[model samples]
Target: MNRQAQAVILLLLGGAVLRASVTDQYLNYVKPGLRGFLIAAAVLLLLTGAAALWQGMRTGSPAPDGHDHDHDHEHGHADDEDGHGHHSPRVAWLLLLPALGLLLVAPPALGSYAAGRTGTALTAPSDFAPLPAGDPVRIGLLDYASRAIFDQGRSLGDRRVQLTGFVMPGPDGTTILTRMIVSCCAADARPIKVALGGDLPPGIAGDPNEEQWFEVVGVYDARTVKDPVNAESIPYLRVVEAKAVATPAEQYES
Candidate 1:
């Protein structure tokens, strides 16, 4: 690409990155901790592109063959006559496609469509303490799963709990409460989920494809359910109440 085109592409990509980072939209695809890095990268790109643009305007465009006409070609080696010696490779131009896509139509974050494709269970560590006093203790999906599956539900101990996640359909005609755990970005996101033991009301079970978010108040059921396909331990929750809720500002948990 020519200097002008390269500069424009850089500015656009930097703008897109800044927009995503400033508005908290970056959380949809990446961990919350990456905010600083994204912002730094955007600033650097903008500065570099602005500098290149200024230089391009001052120096004018290159020759059709990408050679500097003002240079002393007469004294140069015979092999330099082809003009291809200093030209950039054509493959570098392909980098513009991602920038254009980001500017025109950004892709949505991974959701139910992604969760259904992968069936690996997420396990938590075994260092949890007893549940504090609360009718319903708000806890993360991954933490609950870890205690339930790995620690054998000792920490839960009859305490009511609350979890928020989207609906994921199970192979046995059941619906699961599911959330994706993102370490750095969407590419590394993995699903953590639990099976709702009792019958779900008509409203909450209405549309599995919609990927509706919900806050479920329930207690852990000691009875462990096993994934027949993978033989992984699946956590279970006995639902006391279920309410439809707005999707959280940050879709994925760290």
Candidate 2:
């Protein structure tokens, strides 16, 4: 690898980062709050690449004959082994692989496949509060699970809750409403799910594994049992109504 190759790699990485940030695809992999940092990083990389390319192109004048040439010659061997050689480490070239994947494949966000493979736990707020007034109270799946398990569904008392998440097929031939919670990125995402019982609405009934997004209006079943896979209390919901919905731009819950 030469200076030009290094510069190109930097530019490719920078461009990919910028594109992800600008196009809102960064939300798929990481949080929205990282957009500014991603942009700044991309800009820095682009500048570094441009500087390298400029320096490489400045061959109009030869170096003055001096001890400087001899000094470089003496240290050339040392530099070569330390990544300052005409041929850089072969591993450095692999950096462009992610850029290529991002550009060409544009991988989809983590979906039901990832959720199904991981066991989940409910995360409740330290200070629980009553649901805001609404015909069908909209609540997060994690919050609901926590309330059902820890609070004995006291806060949920006869309230029809509305929840949104993708479908995760259960072993008992039931569909689960699942959401992935991420503190940073998809790599650390963990699934939080609620078992959907009673009759499901029309659109979701056709295929349990369809991985469709849905908004369900239901009340907590209040039947408590330890979840076999995760060893935590599984929250059950008696589905009163459900409807297919579009996947949100940001799929993961914080």
Candidate 3:
């Protein structure tokens, strides 16, 4: 490809990595195991760039083809122009950096920031049909959070619940929040805030205002009512045990 195009590619790759390093919000779109793909792509980009630069550098005078072949070459000037247009190297491979970022860390959809900012707790129904009851019910934090705002989460009143989300620390540090999954865009992302209500677990409690995916498996410690909005005010799903785990995508379907 041309030097101009190659230059653009080099800049874009560096920009994408910089964004990924700072943005944990993009955890959804990414799948696990993406390091190998990125490394290979980066190496290929560098090699192609080097080759293009070499071609540009080697534009010295062409060798003479035996005396009077000049007339024959005059018409071929058009061919040179055509070759430059058609055979100019393409920097398309440079796009692989952003692609790798998408595969590696497909950002999580919008989260509580949007919800709290708008004074909304993600849209939920008056009730969710029956959550398949199990010995120790494995529920999602988003499910609990959505239900918390609707006053209909009695379905899980005293049952054991399993939730996976990130920690949102409380003031006391005695308890930490576990948030759940959200798909689609962050404009509607909602976090189920379950307070881990037992002895302090290992690791620093999560940053309250950030996104920290975890797995908090515990029994529902009864529900509590918060500042209700109109007739639809749900109760919180208090938990007894919360073990942090990486976020899962299947928890919240778009």
Candidate 4:
């Protein structure tokens, strides 16, 4: 392809690279440590693309072969087999196909895929110490659970509270427990086993999946502690509402 064509291609891809780099959509999909690699790759691609554009424009200059010089190389293969001539750098713009694909079909946000995956708990060890002095704090079941099991003891003792999460597997498949687990950008969040306390909303019901989202209504009730795992150590929030909803990409990245 010609240099102008290559420049157009590279310009489009560079825009995508810049977008993916600045936005949470791509970075949140990656694991904590891996995000840097994608950024570096985008940078390298952008730079190399700029260089390729410069070379493509210079195509107007004479070539040693004295034949029409191929400007853009196809997908990095500078020459065809048997040393045959190739399409100009304009063809290299074809590389943008994959970039376009990724931008459109970006993988679904990590969502609730991370139910029960064990790893570092978010709570600090000091949290287990006697509960901090606060009137009422909104907290997650998993956070309370981890605290009960490992952190120091604290009591909610009739505190007004709010909780949110997805509907998780309960005693029977028909009866669901709503929950939310925040694991590294919600991509691997664990369920917080919230207690339902009120009427249901149209949007908040269903089987939990990797991409589903939910919000719940309820208060923290002391008697609701029945969970065998960490029941004694963790606090429970009594939920009054369960609503299913679609979260914007930015909303889920947290």
Candidate 5:
């Protein structure tokens, strides 16, 4: 509540932002393109906090009468009322809690838990081009979904495709491959889901633990199912191979 406390809060918040921006942690909360802005904002906050703290310390010196004097009469009155110069309510300290948590341990990106609750976001119908030349061409989950659902899997053909996403359990004991799509940040993120069918690869048994990342190799299946949450048709993939994979640096698709 005091000038020093306010400045410390700013510094803590600034440090937390800087830490998230400099590392891969920022990807969990925002798009990759916003990293520069986040870094710039953090630097500005740090500078402002440093300047305010220095100014507060410089102006807090005692007068000859053993009473603190401030440059402004309003501040002096506030100091008189609180005795310790605290100018705001004590509840403001609560803002520091999130800052401290961010600095200590950044939260993980949205995964199966979010995917299960959110309905699949299907893009507007558009003509999709043919898959690139590869035995197992890599494809984004949203793109594949669009091709399967709207285009009726014409672009997909018989080529095997590879998709990388976290696992989400679907209705009727089905498995789902999911990725979050975001225009700006995680607050507006929506799930893009594809149901997985067929047998699992060797050494991988049973349904994967929720939220575990995986790279699945499969071909398009004509089967579509209704989403329990939104009743939207979710396309299917007949998986031929699958393996656990590390989470990517940027988890969300733009």
Candidate 6:
């Protein structure tokens, strides 16, 4: 790639980052707290690219060749007869593909396909605090999983809880309610799953589709099952009610 092309790539990459950071799109890949850093990095890249391009234009820099003609001339050597100077590897241009994808067609967050292939991430056992007072209190999948698996659902008690996540087909044609939890970004995301039992609620009308988002009301079930992929014990939720729902704006739990 030539210097100008390199600069353009920088601009494209910066624009893609800025576009994601300025909207909810960034949430699909990373935690909410990293927005400021992403914006800062994007601005830096844009400024650097702009400066390089401006300098090249103002100085009327030579061809895309990786050489400085004026310096070569001062050294008493004429420009290359072939008019082709050593250039960056052509493979570098491939970087533009991902940049373009981010700009024009950002990928969706990880869902059931990812959840089914990975083992659930369970935190080390710890004494969990009491769940807040509410019948069917809204709770995160990770929190519920940790409490149920490591803490044996002691903190859950008889209170009904609500969870929202995409559905994943589980062993023996069962359903798994899942959410991806990321420590940094999507690349490191791990599934937090709760096996769903009992009939679908009236609002759903049918078996939940794979990757379909749903809001489920249920009480923790003591029964556990092995995750087919990794044989890890997955906790269960006895569904009292469930309904199809749109994917949430922030799909991952940080």
TM-score of each: 0.86, 0.86, 0.47, 0.54, 0.91, 0.89
- Pairing residues by index, what is the TM-score of model 1? 0.86
State the lDDT of candidate 4 residue by residue for 1-254, as single tens digits: 54556666666676676677667666545544556776777777678778877776675555687754443334235455435444453456668796686677665544333433322233554434343454345455455555434432344444444444444443223223434434454446544544343455543334444244565545444433344433322334455555566664443222
Ranking by TM-score: 5, 6, 2, 1, 4, 3
Clash total of candidate 1: 0
- Which parts of model 3 have CA positions greater than 4 angstroms off? 1-120, 171-176, 185-190, 198-214, 221-235, 246-254
User: Cα miss at 111, model 6 (Å)?
Assistant: 0.9
lDDT of 3 by residue, 96-171 (tens): 6674665466654554443333222456676576777686676555666665445454666566677665554443
* Model 1 misplaced regions, further than 4 Å: 61-86, 206-209
Worst 10-residue lDDT window, candidate 4: 113-122
Any runs in candidate 2 off by more than 4 Å, and if so which?
59-86, 224-228
Tell me how candidate 6 scores on lDDT.
0.84
The sequence of per-residue lDDT tens digits that candidate 1 reaches over residues 191-236 is 8878877657654563464478888999888766655557676788
lDDT of 3 at 3: 53
The Cα error of candidate 3 at residue 142, in Å, is 1.9
Better of 4 and 6 by lDDT: 6
Model 3, position 74, has a per-residue lDDT of 42
lDDT value for model 2:
0.80
Give Cα distance to truth, residue 10, candidate 3, Å. 9.5
Worst 10 residues of 2 by lDDT: 58-67
Number of clashes recorded per candidate: 0, 0, 22, 24, 0, 0
Task: Point out the higher-scoring one by TM-score: 1 or 4.
Answer: 1
Question: Mind giving the per-residue lDDT tens digits that candidate 5 earns over 30-115?
Answer: 99999999999999989999999998898887767876756456476877897765589989999898798898878888888888
Please give the distance, in angstroms, between residue 251's alpha carbon in candidate 6 and its true position after superposition: 0.3
Clashing pairs in 5: none
lDDT comparing candidate 4 with the true structure? 0.50
Instruction: Order candidates by lDDT, high to low.
Output: 5, 6, 2, 1, 4, 3
